[model samples]
Target: MNLQVLQQLGMSERDITLYLALFQLGPSSIRDIASHTGINRGTTYEALKQMAARGLISYAPKGKRRFFRAEEPDKLLELAEEKRASLEQTIDSLKTEIIPGLHHLKPEFSSGNVRFYEGDDGIEFVLKDILATVGKLEEKTYSVFSTKSIRHHLYRPFPNYTAQRIKQKINVRVIALGEGGEDAEYSERKWLKTDGQVDASYIAIYPPKVAMISMASENYPVATVIESPDIARAQQVVFEALWRFL
Candidate 1:
């Protein structure tokens, strides 16, 4: 049976078995249900107690013993709907109140920060950082050192990066290590000749941060972001010196 719905409803595996057992053996005592479900009696009772709290099952007195039965299956749907509404409220609170309050608790000054990410998703975050960090600057510009080897993989995670950059009016200056880099609006490109194939790598110097992306063993994409104004400025200086030379 596809029990994904039950799992999504936050039902544990033991609870699922006990719940179905209750369905098959209606109005049964705890001992009968435990024997039928093969779960220990104590665990079975605990599961039933929690399930009852969620309105999944209920019990009443029958002669000398209590008999348990599964509530209407539709109760599961109601529980799910309630969870959805709660989640929406939580998200709103996070956006409106929680996040800003937490930010205030963070340190005012950081000498350095470094983060590492792996695979396509990681590279996408690095690209997003480039846009978010640079877009806020007075210059709204950054520089890139890209190699032809990594050209294909660089934008694979973010094919629309250039379009988004253009929309944001963010400008880039690219120094292509080998041939084969495209030009886009609000961008300047200059190439440097190389004798042999260079390793797949990309570097972006956005003020207050520098992002590096490259292919590791087995062609896995990896990225590192360093948030240091001093380091960023030094790298920017090197890039500008090379830009003027080329």
Candidate 2:
């Protein structure tokens, strides 16, 4: 009476009952099948016709009435195998259609462009890119002003990154906003008190190619990096002027 297997083979509840009755009772007319399953004659005929079309049953005329019998149960395995073959053919056709387009999707190696990355991962990408760009420079200087959220995320990863930056001998002059008030731990430990104090804007110079200017907040965390020689010179002049006084 475990008709769950038949139900899974695309048999409806009434269809399962009729098919199980036919399966158990052997070759029989729709009337006898209906009586055996207690299904109405109309529903029994419908289920019988559908099962016949699916190769689940075979029927032929015997005298004045049609007699129906369940086809070999092995047809269920054949149906599954046929579906598998159809799926494999579909997958192979798609592979042929898509593989050639992959080469066209490849980027040209010499092409340089500004790309926008989204969300927290974008922020991480920009920050990590800054680290890589600075690591190759002979000298690096930055005046960074950060908001609370940026400060929190920075603190989480700062220890390891700070160690890496220090080993590179990349001098970073940070100027972060004293947003969480005067005696913040990030300000005391990371900020250079006199030369590198907290401010409302961020400025950083890593010799040759990069500088990050970030204004971080809950709603608008904008980190902009200027990679032009002329702008780098302008920032350096401003940073040096501020560095000299402090």
In order, candidate lDDTs are 0.90, 0.61
lDDT for each residue of candidate 1 in 174-215, tens digit (9 for 90 to 100): 999989888889999999999998888899999899999888
With candidate 2 superimposed using the best TM-score fit, by how many Å does residue 109's alpha carbon deviate from the native?
21
Model 1 — TM-score against the truth?
0.67
The TM-score measured for candidate 2 stands at: 0.40
Model 1 CA deviation exceeding 4 Å by range: 116-143, 149-174, 181-201, 205-209, 213-223, 228-246
Among all windows of 10 consecutive residues in model 2, the one with the lowest summed lDDT is 184-193
Candidate with top TM-score is 1
Candidate 2, position 226, lDDT: 47
**lDDT by residue for model 2 (166-235), tens:** 5655555554344342342222213333334443334445444443434455434344554565666776
